[model samples]
Target: MSEAVQIASIKDDGAIPVYVARPAAAPKGAIIVIPEIFGVNPGIRQKCDKWAANGYLAVAPDIFWRFAAGVELDPDIEAQLNQAFGYFQQYDPADGVYDIESTIRWIRQDAGAIKVGCAGYCLGGRLAYMAAARTDVDASVGYYGVMIDTMLDEAHRIANPLMLHIACEDQFVSAQAQAAVHAGLDGHPRVTLYDYPGMPHGFAAEMGDRRHAAEAELADARTEAFLAEHLA
Candidate 1:
């Protein structure tokens, strides 16, 4: 259902490698799967597959290809986690969002997709929020997105449906940040926010210690329903 593919990068003459998944039946729409700090690893690929199984064309781009390609880090490994954080420190979300914007354009023009949405995790979650405001993505969803509070000024640019899943006890995000997020966009007519009371930062991860089974399931179910409703 999924395979490695390439998308043309308008900024350059090269092709960007991407993991693409297609549904068994005709796709209802396309969902771009934005990866966490770990890049396009197995977990991220699985996310694309999950979306494909749900009747969407799922595409995951390598946002770190500007500096590194084929990155697959494990959070449980001390060294890898540190390396991931290092990459995070070096990554500029503005550049990453540009890649996301190109991906959306490719999905629409090259892939023949009628509707395109985005679902992002961790750092990707922040990009999802940006996409809601900056791109033509039909709908956007973010899970425990870090640093979103700092970009609240751009909330007025969000013209489509946007959703966010917040882990109430996320170690990476502070109480003040969460409150700011709520205060800034809680009343936005096109936005919906969900809070998971006892979840941690990566509670919805596909595997490992960060995965909180029940909470992840609940959030994913909500995401699927939201995507189906909006993209359809």
Candidate 2:
């Protein structure tokens, strides 16, 4: 079983709310799980629990708390999407990276983890890459990150191990963008990219009917293996 705890973030200008999930036993490592623009919804919480089940202390910070507190998007497709995209534009990626780094530091100090990694979905996924570029994370896993192409120029500077899971049929991310990211990391031995054919943007989200069971399972296994190898 996993336990949920509330953590406070440093007040730069305001307070940030963070939710942490961990197993009863000592953690092997710590993971800073970043959430999508919808904030730390049930799906994100499940992701944290999944990580905790794998022996890592997982913490997810409310990235949108600065804009709105405890946001939960409606299940209606159009409404949910509008809310998700709306928050995405309101918060800058730099802020997300800083908040994530803060969460990482908090976990390192409170949980006493030796190594740390990051995993995120959608907007969080893109932020995962940015966190890896800016912070000292042991590993990073990005699932269908949209803005990764824009940061290709800085890819060579990334020293941490990075893994990207891309949805080949995703309308939001174009082939050109994927190519740019690949080209940027072409010779980088620390980066690995995988494309899931026919999978949508939030395929790994189990709460929705869009969940691709096989694909999600495969990605989960891959993510676990990557974290175990790097953080263990």
Candidate 3:
């Protein structure tokens, strides 16, 4: 139900390798899956598969292709963490937004998509928020997005539905940062924010040590239902 596809990146004119997943029947909608700093690893691919199984056309782009085209880093490896951060620091979010927008356009034209949303984990979580604010995406969901508080002012620009899952106990996101994110967008009519009481960063991702099945299931359920309602 999944295959690799190549898409053009406007920034470099290089092929951005994307993993595409198709549903057995006509899709209800489409979603662009954005991975953590770890690139399009197994967990991200599985997420795409899950979306496809849920009857949505799903694709996950290798946004880190700019530096490491197909990099998959182990979270437990110190060297890998350093390398991931190196790529993360070198990569620009604006360029990422463009790539995601490109993916959205591809979904729209090639898949005949009626409604399209985006979901991101970790670093991608922030990208999802930026995409919703800047692109034509119909909806977006972000899980434990890092550095989101710095860009909350852009929340006013979102025209479609957005759901954010904040891990309350996440070390990557401080208490003050979570409070800032909530204060900025919680009351917005188009935005919905949920707090996971004791979840950590990457809890929804099926990666080593960090995966929390119960919390992930609950959050994914909410994500699917939200996308269903907004993209229906």
TM-score leader = 1
- Candidate 1, residues 77-135, lDDT tens digits: the string is 89999999999999999877888888888888856857999999999999999999998
lDDT string, candidate 2, 39-158, tens digits = 787888888888888787888888887778788674337888797888877887887877887787777888785789999988889998997788888999999998799888778678
The TM-score between candidate 1 and the true structure equals 0.97
Ranking by TM-score: 1, 3, 2
TM-score for each predicted model, relative to the true structure: 0.97, 0.94, 0.96
- Can you rank all candidates by lDDT, best first? 1, 3, 2
Please write out the lDDT profile of model 3 over residues 73-161, one tens digit for every residue: 87777898898888888988988898998898888887894799999998899999999899989999999999999998898899999
Q: What is the C-alpha RMSD, rounded to one decimal, of candidate 1?
A: 1.1
Poorest 10 consecutive residues by lDDT, candidate 2: 2-11
Which residue segments of model 1 deviate by more than 4 Å?
Answer: none
Taken over the whole model, the C-alpha lDDT of each candidate is 0.91, 0.82, 0.91
Angstrom error of the Cα, residue 165, model 2: value is 0.3
